[model samples]
Target: MDVDDGRTARARPSSWAAVAIGTVAVIWLAFWVLKAVFDVVALLFAGVLLAVFLHGIAGWLSRRAHLPAGWALAVTVAAIVAVLGAGVWLIAPSLAAQVDELSQRLPEAARRVADHIERYAWGRRLVERLSEAQGLPQARQALLGATRLLSTTLGALTGVIVVLFVGLFLAAEPAAYRRGLLRLVPIARRARAATVLDDTGHILRRWMLGKFCSMAAVGVLTWIGLSLLGIRLALALALLAATLTFIPYLGPVLALLPAALLGLLQGPAMAGYVIALYLGIQLVESYLLTPLIQRSTVALPPGLILAMQVLLGALTGGLGVVLATPLLAALVVLVKRVYVEDVLGDATVDQGEGAPLPGLPEQR
Candidate 1:
């Protein structure tokens, strides 16, 4: 009997070792699979954001306008199309003219900035090193870098069509998808999963509202300030800043580069004013626009969002960075509900406590 027990114990260890190896292998394969579909996953998340936005608007229509869900969605789509069409009709000509002018002048502005930079010993050496590494002169290297950046922006523009179509379809029959997702969970946990999903949708809807408000406020303020300072292409530049603001931290910086470059074309004083204008606009967003809009949304740490942007940007590029905040918000909701509440028995997760968001019931 003792010999038999010793043999069984030895067999158990081998079985456990095999299980561990299998688990590790499975995890590695899963990571490889995720990497392959990273762009698709990012676009799906963007689609999710769009669905949340459309649903929020549709919910309001259903509740307040006394419309059926189908009709509400139809109205929402029509309204969006009308607004976009009107905006294009009203602004396209002027915007196109400004864009053309900016394009024609930007190379000169860039050359000027390069000249200024090259006046500094450190800048000259850095440019020389970069130029040598690229097997091109400094001027050619700079232009190549700008061309690559513009190409990347164009690539992102192409992805917007995919996100829009996916979002529209998902938003059209969100409840069906919700039901499908709940079925994926264990039968016993489906109810809890439903609650978490609902809460996630609520938080994301609030986030969408907040982002829209911020974008509008920033765009208007930037346009007003630039116009007051008599800066050219104020409308086009303001619109660019507004659109880019959706990407969070890095976006404003990218917007600032062109604004500052244009400002420098006028004079150093004009450049300083432009810098101050952006700083003022950002301060308002940080203090007022953000606070008011985010009051009912999940408040993520800025540092954490920025860190995720860096990590995801490295892995999946621009799309990852753009979708990072919403993804993090969803993760936060899951961790709080699943890990904190269920596993640790902690009831005080502060899942958007305080003022009630519109279209969402008060949290118990």
Candidate 2:
């Protein structure tokens, strides 16, 4: 008995030491692997998000419309294509006109802007300081360099095609793909994977639907307001706002730029109207629309969004930036449902942040 116990104890210690070493090695390997391949991983997560969201819509349509799931899927796909085609048809004329007008007016606008800058007190002080500090020449060169840098990206065209294809394929047969994945996992983990898939579907659908609703509201408001203000290309700017609204934080800010610029071209008073229009839109979005539509998930915090944007942008270029939040939401849902709910314990009713976002899909 003594010999057997001694041998068992010795073996246990050795096993524990080996396990510790293996754990550290795994951590190191995972760190490097994630660093090296975050873009591909991020894209995969984005795929999962798209799949979940589409499936949710399919399910909803199937339920509410009392159609077969397959037929609902077909309708959903048709709706997506129709929306895209209609948007293109609707905005093409206004966009082309706006582009031509901007092309003609940009030089005059630039000259006027320079003159206005030279007249402004802060602008005059900046000019004087730059001249005194011998910064003007360097600043001009730096401005050109910055413009060049902004114009060039590592990968853009290819990434857009990839995202489009990924989103399309994922939406087509998400259940089959998900089931195949869960089957690959151990039998013990299969249930957990199922729950994760369910949770993910819920979160993604809520997010996409809620955001779309809010964006539509914003677009309608923008279109109506700009039309009222006598702005050129009101439809175009409104469409831009709706499209950019998918981006979060930076989106509305970007919408303001073209609106203000167009307003400036129209007249100083019109510029005020444009700014006021966007501001009013922003107010409505924050106070009314978002509250009504986006009451579920708030998305990840701005800092995390910015960090993911920078990271994904660095890795997969702009596609990563665009899909970052959806990707993050998918990850959070998977982790929460599988780890916190399945492995660690049942999900707490008093869970902090509930689902860590405002637009998480309903459990139903």
Candidate 3:
């Protein structure tokens, strides 16, 4: 009996070791699987954000115009399409011309920059280091990278079409989708899940509203400022600035690069003035516009947002960086509602109020 007992103990340890190995293997496989699907998941999340925007507008139209939800949503979509189509039709030619000019001028601008840098001893050293970095192999790698980027851009265009369709479908029947999602949860926890979903949607909607307002303000201000500065391709630069403003910290820096390069083409004084204009615009947007617009929304810490952008950009490239802020915002909501309040028993955390989710009851 003692011998049998010893044998059983030894067997148990082997079994436990096997289990641990299996668990580790499963985790490694899951990680790879998730990495593979991460881009698809990000695209779906982008569609969700678009849906939120559409639904929010439809809700407002429903309330104000006394229209049925479906009709309101249809009107909202039509209006958006019309506005976009009209804007494109009106501005595409001029914008295209400016974009072409900007592209042609940028190479010259870069050369001018290199010449200026060669003037100072420290700048010469910097240029030498840069040149050294851009060896034959590095140049080959850059060509390959550009090729990959072009392919990725094509893929992204397809993804945008998918996102648009997904958004339209989701906005059309938000309740059905919400119910389907909740059905995945256990009956006992489904109510809580619904609440969390509603809160997340509300928060996302507010963020979108604030972001649109900020983008418009930045675009208009940039165009005005660049025009006054006599900067060539002001329209293209303004458009670029407005679009990049969607990505937060890294975006502004990127937008500034082209504008600054263009300014450098003009002269050192113009470059300085261009830099000051961008800085002033950023200041006003960060301090004044955002605070007033997003007062009722949850304020994300700038540091956290920047960190997330860097991490995601490294992991998943441009799409990751573009979607990082909204993804982080949704994550914050989930952590607060699910982990902090539910798991940690800290129910006092204030979840900022916003527009009620299209099909969810308002939580008082």
Candidate 4:
């Protein structure tokens, strides 16, 4: 008996170690496979986020205006399209002209930039270093590489229409679909499940509203500031700023690049004015607009936001970054409420305050 018992005990550690090693290896393989799959579905994720955003707005309009939910959703979606159309109409001509002009002038800019590099002291040293490392003749090769990136950007544009259509469908039928989904939950847990759904919608709605307002404010301020500074491509630049504002810190900085570069091309005085204008716009956005828009929503920690962006971007590139925050925030709420508070919870803590939930009337 003692011999058999000793053998079993000796084998247990080896068995546990084998299981652990096997689990980790399986997990690693699954992670890579999942990343590849996620890349394909990344756009659908963006569509879902958009649907969540529009769905919440639909609910608010339905409740407040006493409109049919479908009609409210239709109205909201139409308003978005109208604003986009109007913006395009206002800027289309100038944007086309600017693109044509840019296509023509870019070569000249490249030549000038090259000439400046050859003439400038710091640029000369950097060129020598790059030449040593890459064995390339000149930095013009790098410029050409950048132009190819613009061509590839057109491919990303193709996904836009697909996402738009998906978003529309989601906006139209969110509630019916969401209810159907909740049917999978056990009857006893349905009330808690419903609360989770409601809270998710609220969090998503507040986030969307806040982002929309912030983007609008930033766009308007950017346009007015750049225009006042006599910066070229003011309208196109403004729109870019607004669109990029969805991206957080990186977006505003990207908007600044064009405005500042154009200002530099104009002269030092124009550049100085452009810098000051942007500074003022930043102040207004940080102090005024953000507070007003975010009043109803909790601010996410900056480090977590950046970390989520990088992680999502690694898995899905651009689309991941677009949907990261709202998804994570909703998930955070779900985790705390469902897993921590409800599932593996301390019953005594809640029992001290109110009657047990199970005994209460279902309607309450």
> Model 1: residues >4 Å from true position, as ranges?
1-32, 134-158, 351-364
Model 3 lDDT vs. the true structure?
A: 0.91
How do the residues 35-70 of candidate 1 rate in per-residue lDDT, one tens digit apiece? 678888898888889988998899999999899988
Higher-TM-score candidate of 1 and 2: 1
TM-scores for candidates 1 onward, in order: 0.83, 0.71, 0.84, 0.75
Ranking by lDDT: 3, 1, 4, 2
lDDT of 2 by residue, 1-364 (tens): 9999999998998999999999999998976787678766665666566666677788889999999877887898789889989978987787889867766765766566667899889988877786788655888989988887765543445545566678767777677778888889999878867876766677778888888888888899898988888887787788889988887667788888877877887778888888988888888886786666535753466688778778777766656777877777777776666676667765562255554433457665
Model 3 ranges off by over 4 Å: 1-31, 120-150, 351-364
Q: Per-residue lDDT of 57-164 in model 3, one digit per residue for the tens? A: 999999999999999999999999999999999999999999999999999999998897799999999999998887769788999999999998999899999899
TM-score: the better of candidates 1 and 3: 3
Highest-scoring model, TM-score: 3
The whole-model lDDT of each prediction reads 0.89, 0.76, 0.91, 0.76
Report residue 233 deviation for candidate 4 (angstroms): 1.2
**CA deviation > 4 Å runs, candidate 2:** 1-36, 42-46, 64-68, 120-157, 297-299, 314-317, 339-346, 349-364
The positional error of residue 198 in candidate 2, measured at the CA in angstroms, is 1.1
What's the count of clashing pairs in each model shown? 0, 9, 0, 0
Residues 173-285, model 4: lDDT tens digits? 87777789799999999889999888777777787888888888888888888877766677777877888888866667777766666676777687678877877777787
